[model samples]
Target: MKTRTKSEMNKIRDIAEDYYIRLGKKGRDIADMLGVTEQTIIAWKKGRDGERTWDERKRDMELTPLKIRELILQEAHKTLSGQKSELDADRLAKLMAAYDRLSKKTNPRTVMDVFMMFDNWMTDEEPDLVVKFTEYHRRFLFYIIERES
Candidate 1:
């Protein structure tokens, strides 16, 4: 049997983690692919000592906007690729809406961009209301900051 260094073992573990969490592979399958024992993969999934478990990592990843977007994209891709029976228009639309909502929540810059564009349009079209709009915009910005905090 060949001896593996700490770095090599860590690299293998990382690959296993990605397969199990990101690619949704089973531990036994990952172990077979990585040429490691199933027990080793199980241990890694459960976490060594104080480290976080693979399930915990997966849950955390699922909670993130980026991960949610990735999942939505994956589902869309599957549908487009004919892996799924048919294109679920309603489901896809809902997923995209959820993705947009999550994206806006994580990225305040999107809100700012939309607000700036609207403010510019208001300034040009309704010049007299600019002062009131400015006050409202200020309050809105403060509200956004408060919501974020």
Candidate 2:
């Protein structure tokens, strides 16, 4: 492919960054969609090569109820799938607690409350399950958000 001119590159970056922030697209995914190298997307995000970056993008992103459900399920799957030992009740409890919050919410406010509960669980380390669960949530959140959008 021919090299993109500066003006053309700027226009592309503007649109791509909008989607990257608004739709939660990953750098690699956006790069593939735009026929650019993933490194170019990373460079654009970093404001290198004179391209603008989507600063404060993470602050704009918010989690939904279904996102929390996927987080819970993915965490459970990750934890159980590679375990050489049996999953103890404590590990199972973490997943159950997250799911329980989702199951009981009947209003927007309550759902947000449940979301916060799970968000806090992301920092938990007692059973180690919560930590790994949080990692999976972070890893999948971008793809899930982009897919929903």
Candidate 3:
């Protein structure tokens, strides 16, 4: 069998990492998909040498919506800071559009916000059920928070 170059091995490892962490794929599945052995994938995940494990990388690289939006804005600023060109302008436009889309009001509100709005409406429209609703709402909110955690 031909030996792979360092760059080729690094490329394969990066793809395997994406499949395993970002896509939440199993080691065996990733190995099969990438034409490697399950042991190889496992070794990569566990950090064969002194390098950090895939799980550690995943934990460190968690991306939230706000973080993504910030990245887009940063990219836009970088694009603007470069020399002016048509391609740079186009890239900037796309980045700005992505930032605007991410910042839109249509983004999901927290469960508490939605529930509080509903509670207020119910208090105004049907004040008699407020006490019972509050009890159930508190339980439901805790359930959701616990599940999310």
Candidate 1 error regions (>4 Å)? 64-149
Per-model CA lDDT versus the true structure: 0.83, 0.67, 0.76
- Candidate numbers, best TM-score first, in rank order: 1, 3, 2
Q: State the lDDT of candidate 3 residue by residue for 20-102, as single tens digits.
A: 87678999999889888898998899976778899987776576667877666676666667744434667667866776775
lDDT of 1: 0.83
Model 3: how large is the Cα RMSD against the reference?
15.7
Residue 149 C-alpha lDDT in model 3? 62
RMSD of 2: 17.7
Q: Candidate 3: where are CA atoms >4 Å away? A: 63-149
Better of 1 and 3 by lDDT: 1
Q: Could you give candidate 2's per-residue lDDT for residues 1-149 as a string of tens digits?
A: 79889999888887788768767888888998888888888777776545444655544345556776776666667667875434455776776786787566454434444545786865553545666665665656555555546
User: Which residue pairs collide in model 3, if any?
Assistant: none
Model 1 C-alpha lDDT per residue in residues 4-54, reported as the tens digit of each score: 999999999999998988678998899999999999998899988988999
lDDT of 1 at 47: 88
Residue-pair clashes per prediction, in order, are 0, 0, 0
Report the error of model 1 at residue 31, Å: 0.3
